[model samples]
Target: MSFPKYPEYKDSGVEWLGEVPAHWGVKQLKYLVTCLDGQRIPLNGVERYSKQGSVPYWGANKIMDYVDEAIFDEELVLLGEDGAPFFDVGKPVAFHSSGPVWPNNHIHVLRPGDSAWVKSIVYGLNATNYIDFVEGSTRDKLTQSRMMSIPLAWPPHDERNHIDSFLDHETARIDALVEEQQRLIELLKEKRQAVISHAVTKGLDPDVPMKDSGVEWLGEVPAHWNVVKFKYLIAEFEQGWSPQCDGDQAETLDEWGVLKVGCVNYGVFDPTENKRLPDNLEPRPELSIRKDDLLISRANTRDLVGSAAHVPMDYPKLMASDKIFVVRLHQRICRSRYAVVYLFGKGVRHQIELQATGASSSMLNIGQGAIRELWIPLPPDSEQDRIVHELEKREADFAALEQETVRHMRILNERRSALISAAVTGKIDVRGWQADQQSRQSEILMAAETRATYG
Candidate 1:
């Protein structure tokens, strides 16, 4: 529903703050709050954090590693200093903190002179388009100097509380609806994985006799299937080449693009995950990608290492990077689909998780020898083709459903941002806006649900 506007309005001197309630005054942050930028103690020196430690600690936009003791025991607003899309309304710039808390240097900590000002200022800062205050080209950085200069429309104390209380209840309702959509997206993904895992290990014929495939992960498969080492099924398995190229200058040009390891990270082939080669660079012929070639990541984070994707079509100039392996199954192995599904299947993914090695916790690697040695259930040529055909049909169906859910979530986020901006910016007065939690919750979800159903 469209919210009511103030009965009287007057122009505010600031450009972004056009008009506000007649009595409302425009005030700079410097007058209303004390900017404390020196209280920060870096998280690197401490083992415990504010969230996990004796007190609460805040970073740029989240509760990161906490610190030992609570430095500030008052109400404050946190404006992110870096590492966020400040211009994007979907990612909020301002957040509230109360009680004993320690904020890192990555945020501008503000203790408003009046405690009652806390929520109104936070809502105002969140509603503000940070494109006007934020700096830096590669990453956004909001400094204390710029933050103090920004102005917010200040209403009366009673009106401030009303606005604050109104938003607290309303935003929570919006947040709950968004949370439900997020949970559904995750459930859909899990179901997709389960469907493929079941189809590959157990043939479509559920009544068919089952036998232990001998592998620990693959408990039982059709009696006729053979368990074999990964090496025997492939004609060639080679790691991709690493060519010297400037990351800053690299583009996705047609003539000289090299596949980055990201090509396999998405669970499907993404050719856009390639970098343009240097002018002088010439890649070897074997490094070029063909339609049936299967790309597998050899080095990445714990979860993505050994991620595999079969090339759906030929990409002539694209060469796999050193972080991935290019595999060509033997001609006798029809339609590399069976092997592709088996490698990405839940059972084999678990194996990859266990086998991936790394010098550090963050980075992981899988050796070619380890990949070749891994065991897999090998179905006959004809059976492999049949399984591939069935999986392709199921894959298309699930992909459409997933895309719709993703689109719905995007729409909900945009709506949430617009609603907050309108309430705080005097574009709409929500002082009298109220709804039972159930109806508001359903309203938010239904808007997105209807879109999903229609689209």
Candidate 2:
């Protein structure tokens, strides 16, 4: 759907606002809204924890927590002062909040003269390019004075209301579609995990005879399979060295680098998740990663503490960190891919989480002894190869569907941003627009019919 352009247009002096509707006026943001930055109060994590309650505590980009006290009770708009996604055009840096709320010092609060203008101002600010106003060497900072001088297209009251209403209805429709796609992606992930868990724990043959595995979590397994301890399958295991390194990744494969715990995060080796080794430090040639090396994280968050990945190829320039454990399986009995799939199953993951230990909730560590004692249900060598091949085929199919859904979401987001920018900048006239009530009612009826039929 396309919107009609204004009948007449005039050039605006501002470079970003090249032209506007003849009747529309252009003005700086400070003239239309009151700055409430002085009223904001900062809160540390400990302080916020102590005051946790119903009121939302806002930071530069989102709600950080809920606090007991309210700093402002009236409706207002908040813009990021720093640490926001300023460069991402599809994402918003300005948001509105109503009722009781506490905003931190990292956001600049704005009180528009008319409550009706709040949504319009937010839409305009999000559409505007902030490159000319934002400053800072490391982080983008929109200072109070710079934000005040930013330009906006000011339309008559009635026209502004029309744009806001149209945007509210249209964006809601797009958001719903985006939400559906997001939910589909999450469902696909859950299904993928389920398939892996079932394939690894219980063999692919559904009718195979089963027996109790004795362990409660590993309820039952194929009668032919054996439940063995992990230690029996390992040919070799060793922890890696950690050396102070540069923050950036190595530019070339020839440059020395040390792997971070995140290298095995997704159950696949990521060579790029490594820091460049300093030139002055001596390299550990013995610890260099090799092809078929199975790596696991010894220290990470609880969910990822025992994450393991099978190295598909060699990364000779990279050495593992102390937080990672390198292992080699007894190839005669177990394949690296088979071991990785088994470790990633829900049953094994439960054991890893239970054994992980740490003083802080954010980080946990698992010892080598704890890992070796974990139980594994083993099938014959030929069965392991067949399971791995079948899993790879299924994974590829799921990945293609996920990629298509993600592509659709990207297109929808681009359309949303373009519509908002065009309407707020007066590139499109919305005064004559009205909501299609009959069409919305038809959609509602169709949705109901779908549920009835599907259910």
Candidate 3:
């Protein structure tokens, strides 16, 4: 949908905002709003908890955590002072927070002197590009004085409320649809996981006689299958060495690189996660990744501690880091591709969780003993090969569907951002525009129904 431009425009004397409706007024942000800088609490002072509290602790980004208490109890807007980038339209830099928010020093809390300006200020800040006003090298910082000096485009108070109401309704609808698409993607992922779990744990022969696998996650297997400790199938397994190197430099094509833990985190090989080796260091050639090699993450969050992936491509000079382990398997005993599926499957995942050792608050690590000792229900090599082939074929269609759903979600989010920016910036007048949009939507729905009936 397109919006007509406002009639009779005048120069606003601001470069970013070229022109505005003739009747609109321009004011510096400082004069139009009240800055409550004194009300902020430091992050360390703000007690953090996991879903155990009532009050929201608003930081530079979304609610960083929920605490036991509230510092302020009224509705206000919070803009990032640093840490959060303003260029991202998807995650807005300004937040319209309400009801018992404990704001931190990383953001500026503001209340409009006129209650009517509340939503307008939020919309403007979110739409405005703020790279000009921020300071600091690592993280951009928006200083209080710079924020106060910024010019804001202001319309009539009543018109401000009208624009606010229009955006609130439209963005909410767009957000709900985006949420639906997101839920669909999650469902697709779960379906993909189920396919892998079934094919790897239970062979393609459903009518075959079954026996107890003795593993809780793998309840039953084909009668001929045997459950054995992982050590029996592995020739050897060991974590790789790490050499000190600056991580930000470009990687040389044929030089040594140390793989980060994320390479196997998502059940795929992500070669881009490696760091370039320093010229002074020499890496052992035995550690270099070869075609058909298997790798697993030794240290990660407990949920992903034992994640494994098969390397389908060979690399010249890449070796694993200490956080990841290279697996040398006896192929006669177990198929490599089958091993990938079983390690990431539901039942074996639980075993990995049980074996992972670390303080509850930190990253979990699985020892060589645990990886070797964990039991697996195995089929013969030929059956393993068949299972892998069937799963890959079944997942191909679901993966395509998931990719398409993700593209649709991205388009919806882009539309949401464009709609909000247009309504707030007076590029379009939204007063009573809600009813017009509703009518147009009804017409489109009616047209679709009429087409379906005729065909």
Candidate 4:
């Protein structure tokens, strides 16, 4: 294909592309693309999966189901039309493929003159923060007018094809690496859970005989340990203050209050996201969290409801949310960390789930009455300390590995986006590329063969 030659310019905010050939046109997103609102297929109709026949139906979240027909089979650029997912510089959006390719109003499907050209634009959009302008509560909605007004950089057909092919290969490679790292992270998390579950329930020395702790949840513990109720060990189990009162009660120190259900501690004790209570509001002494105090979520998603965190003394004074159950242990009876870990452990979580109310929405309200009655297997003080020490050391090592993996994942993501940004913006030219094309074709063929044989 013949291409046009042009002059270069300065201070264009196109640093990633260095200098764009002047002949290449710059147009508003509206000029280069049209937002073809996706046809909405009923969720029920799409629920049935047809293996041999049917078009793939897409939903805002992903592929909701498969239908027998596709509305637009030709490839297109799909943007999530709805939801509150954080889609910025490195967060890749998953688009749906198949029959009508229906995207919720929460999603917008872009039809381009050339599919290859649009892929380049999509990559650019993904790499740069593309939709920072669209704002709303719940899911951010995109207005067609506003979307068209966004800026777009376009290159000639040949140059666009070259950039698309290069990015198609490089970004996939980076994504594969990121996926591998994510899998490793999942494995580490599983191992962490296993280690915690084993240590707390069985103790370090497995040679000890196992005996039932009477409490069904405490199925088995060290033969020498005593099964005691939680109430017998803690000074008090206080519920959170009701903020619905006075409307002002819900008001935080700042505009929003601290101690909302969302602010409750999960894996870590985070006080930053708390709502601010009114300045003149009297602080509830009962809600005050002390160092090593185990705060457990009393109500939330089922899996996360029983999650707990050990409050560090250095943390500023913050009250527990209504959805959280703050465990003020009698330091004289049990070491706080041990209790925190025990309550947060999978074993205890299962018990909490069994006793918790609310089927559609799981609620973990182990009031002082119920919490006091809940049974715990208590090993001798020395044994508890020993187990805690060994577990803490292993946990620390696991946490360090997790942090390292996360850091590397971040670097890989940054590299992947940079690679796409570079390829799309003409920072690194990939024009008339032959060898890479052959290599990529070979790789795709090999992948197809592998999938056919194994998957």
Best by lDDT: 2
Model 4 error, position 303 (Å): 3.6
Identify the superior model by TM-score, candidate 1 or candidate 2: 2
Q: For candidate 1, what is the lDDT?
A: 0.76
What TM-score does each of the candidates earn? 0.82, 0.84, 0.83, 0.71
Please write out the lDDT profile of model 1 over residues 275-350, one tens digit for every residue: 7777787767678889888788999877788888889888777888899998888847545667777776777888
Off by over 4 Å in 1: 32-76, 97-116, 136-144, 241-244, 247-254, 280-286, 314-316, 357-363, 433-455
- lDDT by residue (342-376, candidate 4, tens digit) is 76677776777776665333233444454666677
Worst window of 10 by summed lDDT in candidate 1 = 446-455
- Maximum-TM-score candidate: 2
**Sorted on lDDT, highest at the top, how do the candidates line up?**
2, 3, 1, 4
The lDDT values for all models are 0.76, 0.85, 0.77, 0.62
Model 3 spans with C-alpha error above 4 angstroms: 1-3, 32-60, 63-73, 81-85, 101-116, 134-150, 241-244, 280-287, 301-303, 354-370, 434-455
Alpha carbon lDDT at 142, candidate 3: 93
List the candidate 4 regions with Cα displacement exceeding 4 Å: 1-18, 36-88, 93-118, 129-145, 214-219, 229-234, 242-257, 261-266, 280-283, 314-317, 353-375, 434-455
Model 2 error, position 261 (Å): 3.7
Residue 30 error for model 3, in Å? 3.8
